[model samples]
Target: MENTVDQNGLDEAIIVALGCNLSGAYTSREALLEAALEAFSSEGLAVVARSSWWTSAAWPDPAGPAYLNGVAVVQTSLDPAGTLAALHRIEARFGRARGELNASRTLDLDLIAHGRRVISDVVMAPHPRAHERLFVMGPLAEIAPDWRHPVSGETAAYLATAASIGRDARP
Candidate 1:
């Protein structure tokens, strides 16, 4: 994660979700997480809050291995594109190689939300799938329990609980 200061020096905060399932993906699960944190520090991004790593059954394919998930709030001066780029860089640093959608991978970093931006394309704030993912909600609630969806206004904890039940029902 590389940081680029804005000309105005204004800081923008963003929520990020992290996950990993492959063993040899990046040395170890713990090390992969550490590498992420180290990248945040290296980029000079301020860590507002962070949740502990969570282990959950792989979605759509429980037979695969469980995934270690986490969420964090960070303050950066970079814009949405810059922030997204930094996240990709961090994932690449951990040996992540994107393949089939939802397929097991080394490391996964998602730009869950950035302020109140409702963007599309590769950088969608208030991620379209975030409210329905317990893995994201569980960790997010830890750091921002009262957080409401910018679009739906639903609470984080509520979404997390709903996801826990809905996850099993999904085809």
Candidate 2:
């Protein structure tokens, strides 16, 4: 998916997935998530549509705190890399720390896609692993059921049903 998208005439939708298992500074996971959504606008990202928070048991360790997850359709002027960087910044503001793989964190913001663009350069658009996780696809489907995968052209609803990971995910 290493390709360039023209930033000049960009009119495609931007999609992002949000997840969190720990509340960090916030008193509740939902509050942390809500604050993150607000931060998006501060960073110049406009959230056009958002899915309701979904819940799932911690993967590989169901005994851990359950996760709250959702997806957002955003409109931004920045390119894929810039968009990813903004997401990271927003995550960091919520105390997200990049450590072990899939470690529980305060915030997890993933750039699922930048319209139909397939970028594999500084950032990966149409996030490489999103399709495999129901936690990601399910919420995405809830908001945009007919959205097509940039590469496979599969509808978000179909992908959500076909996802193998996070089978316990629910809204």
Best of the candidates, lDDT:
2
In candidate 2, stretches whose alpha carbon ends up further than 4 angstroms from where it belongs are: 1-11
Per-residue lDDT tens digits for candidate 1, residues 1-171, read 322222132123488888888755466876787677768756656666777788878887888877888887888888888888888887787778887988988789898888777788767887888888888887776667667777887767688877742253211
As a whole number from 0 to 100, the lDDT of residue 74 in candidate 1 is: 81
> In lDDT terms, how accurate is model 1?
0.74
| RMSD of candidate 1 to true structure, Å | 6.0
Candidate 2 C-alpha lDDT tens digits along 53-128: 9999998788889999998888889888889999999998889989998799999999999989998888988899
The per-prediction CA RMSD against the true structure, in angstroms, equals 6.0, 5.6
Highest-scoring model, TM-score: 2
* Candidate 1 Cα errors over 4 Å, as ranges: 1-13, 25-27, 164-171
Pairs clashing within candidate 1: none
In order of appearance, the predictions have TM-scores of 0.84, 0.92
